[model samples]
Target: MPIYSSDSDSYDVSSSSTRLFQRERPLHSILGGGRVADVLLWRKKNVSAAILLGLTVIWCLFEVFEYQFLTLLCHIAITVLLFIFIWTNGASLLNRSPPKIPEIILSASAFKQVAVTFHAELNRSLIVLYDIACGKDLTLFLLAIASLWILSVVGTYFSSLNLMYLGFVAIGTIPALYERYEHEVDYLAGKSNRDLRKLYKKFDSKVLNKIPRGPIKQKKSK
Candidate 1:
């Protein structure tokens, strides 16, 4: 019975994943499954996208022959640089000045659909939050799995995986910290206002009653 249940669960999980990858969005990607983001992200200059497509074609042709490390490196390098340029510019495009605030936020929402780093961080947060909310045993189990995965990857890929690990950690932590800082400012402002109100009431009831009069006009004369 237990084995049958496990098999059923496994099938359900795989089906869900397959469905998710099959979905589509306009430009960036088709709901995270990855797509040609011509309309979504690459709406501007076509030059970069054209070059990337060209290189991808070449890479594919090479791959048909065999997996050449040089070809792999060339393709990966181009893709990585492409992403860096896009993200750096995308951040600005996502959050323009107050005049285009609405448009910017909307773009960010759309961007999130294809933003791989954002998705990865969100998934990480969900896993951690779930473990914390569930129970200590579950949390420990998750931690063990996470630690083992990191150890194995880093051990097996000392050079490449090390950079990937650092990149993920940095990207995940930075956004979260920015969110916390914004919240902290809001909290402090609220707390200060609340404390000020209490002090006014506690010290002098008339304080609230007094009119906040402007500067008294000096009696003309003397």
Candidate 2:
């Protein structure tokens, strides 16, 4: 028998089980089930912390300090080149072997594969957008419109860099927190979903169904 933990509103099961929004898959599997998931979930705590720290420093440099990316890149390159130049000269004077830099090459096939994948994904997104615009699915169309409206509202408040940093922070923290308290999160999510559905039904019956409509022409089978 497996041990079960219970809270006032949520129950945790220590076994393979489906949860809301997880689509019958484990959280780790849903997150790609590899090093990426490990880092996101804090399985590699040091790596995750280091990545967050690095991102925070970059965000601070760009947003708080107003550093331009190209200027920073050139400064970094100059510093690195200067250090290497001095090291090589000092090594020659000391009769020591200079640093051996590995050659970096861009593979054509890898680039082609990436381009092809990007093209396919872009086409797929365009198709979805077209369908939504065409009103192929009313619910999906409404959802897309609502999402865009929310994004636009958010954009009014935050700059692009601020939004990006907030998104990065959310990505770094939300998944680990969800995995830790998934039972409670899923329970609350399910409850909220049910409530939303009930509200939608009420609105549909009261408002949408009350709207005047023309007679629908049924498609005839040939």
Candidate 3:
């Protein structure tokens, strides 16, 4: 019985160790375990599908149909108002009740929380950018340059809205796909990371090490 229990414990440990990044927590928890994470991970499949469909429709309207935002907004508002007006007036003659519109009072706390989160993220990004600018981390500097260059190239081919739509689609799909095939993805990622490190070390030795630096001067004691 003791040997069997020990084998079971070993199995559990091995199983967990094999998980992507050897994460102690589940992917949902890593993604905040909130409604947003649920949608992204497709825990609520209907909601996720609806959101993606809505975004695709909007993207099509803007990109394929060349629809203006204000024009679409006004047209929707007009149609809604017309329907509501007809329902309210026609209900009296038809001996029926008018459509009830639900009140949508926005919460101040929700806005405040969103603002705080955005501010924190912005500050964190700025700090990273500052460090990259200061040449504090060579790897980060190269990564920043490469990312910006890629963005520039992509921008030349796609508009801002196209990029946003693509990003949303990626966010909606990538997490779920990764969660499903995490073991394989992690293995590939680990291999690529090791290869990148080797390349970086080689580059550092060949080029960076050859760069000359000025001697540091000592301050005189008063």
Better of 1 and 3 by TM-score: 3
Error of 2 at 117 (Å): 7.5
Model 2: per-residue Cα lDDT over 26-103, one tens digit each: 889877697878999999999999999999999999998999999989998999999899999999899998977654
Worst 10 residues of 2 by lDDT: 7-16
**Residue runs of model 2 more than 4 Å from their true location after superposition:** 1-18, 92-97, 102-141, 217-222
User: What TM-score does each of the candidates earn?
Assistant: 0.21, 0.74, 0.77
Off by over 4 Å in 1: 1-109, 112-135, 138-153, 161-222
Model 1, span 21-110: residue lDDT tens: 133332134323233233223333364446545555654555445556786788899997887777777777788432223576678667
TM-score of 3: 0.77
Q: Write the per-residue lDDT of candidate 3 for residues 107-127, one digit (tens) a residue.
A: 677778889878987998798
lDDT of 1 at 138: 46
C-alpha lDDT of all candidate models, in order: 0.51, 0.82, 0.81
Give the winner by TM-score: 2 or 3. 3
Query: Could you list the CA RMSD of all candidates, in the order they appear?
Result: 23.2, 4.6, 6.4
